[model samples]
Target: MSRTVAWTPEATETFDIIVELIETKWGFASAQKFVRTANQTILTLASHPEMFVTVKGQTIRRAFITKQTSLFYEITEQQIILLYFWDNRQEPIL
Candidate 1:
């Protein structure tokens, strides 16, 4: 069964920041493209919560939206909880 996907406040905030950075660095078209890709990835996660490999020794799974950006989430019984978006070049917080 497909599970629901819920975003944490941190996830929402990070997503906005990522879009803004993309828009500033690239353009509106690029930002829109990224948004579409992120939404599609989330939809895929809804049906396949474990599609991405989990963080070593942790329950959090990371899905790559782009080479530079990734979505982190945790799978629960009824849903996938989005934690935050990480810039892959930066040292991972988790």
Candidate 2:
């Protein structure tokens, strides 16, 4: 069965911040594209939670939504819980 996906408060906040930053630095169109891409990626994760590589020695897995943005999530038996949206240009959080 396909697992559901859930976003934590931190994930939601960071996602909004990243979208706003994209709109400011790029354009509204780019921001929209990012949203669509993120949605598609989330759908993919629902069915294939292990598609992305897990963080070494960690339970979290990371998926690159774009060249500049990545998503961190943890897979559970019933759901994939989103942890954060990270800016790849910045220092690694994990």
RMSD in Å for candidate 2, one decimal? Answer: 0.6
TM-score quality measure for candidate 2: 0.97
Deviating ranges (above 4 Å) for candidate 2: none
lDDT of 1 by residue, 1-94 (tens): 9999899999999999999999999999999999999999999999989899989969999999999999999999999999999889899888
TM-score of candidate 1 versus the correct structure, residues matched by position: 0.97
Model 2: per-residue lDDT, tens digit, 1-94?
7998999999999999999999999999999999999999999999999999999879999999999999999999999999999999999878
Give candidate 1's error at residue 71 in angstroms: 0.4
For every model shown, the clashing-pair count is 0, 0
lDDT of 2: 0.95
Looking at model 2, residue 47 earns an lDDT score of 98
